[model samples]
Target: MKLSFLGQSYEASNPAIAATDTGETLTFRGKSYSQKQFNVALRQPTEELTYRGVRYHR
Candidate 1:
């Protein structure tokens, strides 16, 4: 379940998007991703995300 996010590459396991009073944020492992630059990864996936100008897929 390799995924491509933005345009860069990364490895994610059981990734999840967490939203609070601030905004939306992608969290996985021990890292947190808040859409900034374009990035992608090849490993595993828990979901497919595509919103506004952000894109995450396998």
Candidate 2:
């Protein structure tokens, strides 16, 4: 069985705020997000997945 959760994506919406580098940060609309969220959304080119804005990578 596969369980899933809803998440946000960069494609449908333009986050408006953005950042670069490890220490730096980004924000979707006004909510703050981690670098992984930005990377997975903008860089990886992978399918949509759950991103809780914590523990960016496994």
Q: Candidate 2: list runs displaced more than 4 Å.
A: 1-21, 37-58
Q: For this target, which candidate reaches the highest TM-score against the unseen true structure?
A: 2
lDDT per prediction? 0.63, 0.49
In candidate 2, residue 4 scores what lDDT?
42
In candidate 2, what are the lDDT values of residues 1-58, reduced to their tens digit?
3344476333343334443557657888899956632333444444544568543431
Question: Model 1, residue 25: what's the lDDT?
Answer: 81
Worst lDDT run of 10 residues, candidate 1, spans 35-44
Q: Which clashing pairs does model 1 show?
A: 4-57, 5-39, 5-40, 7-39, 8-39, 8-40, 9-40, 10-41
Report the alpha-carbon TM-score of model 1 versus the true structure. 0.19
Q: What is the TM-score of each candidate against the true structure?
A: 0.19, 0.23
Question: In candidate 2, where is summed lDDT lowest over 10 consecutive residues?
Answer: 36-45
Q: Go through the candidates in order and give the C-alpha RMSD of each one to the true structure.
A: 16.4, 16.2
Evaluated against the true structure, the overall lDDT of model 2 is: 0.49
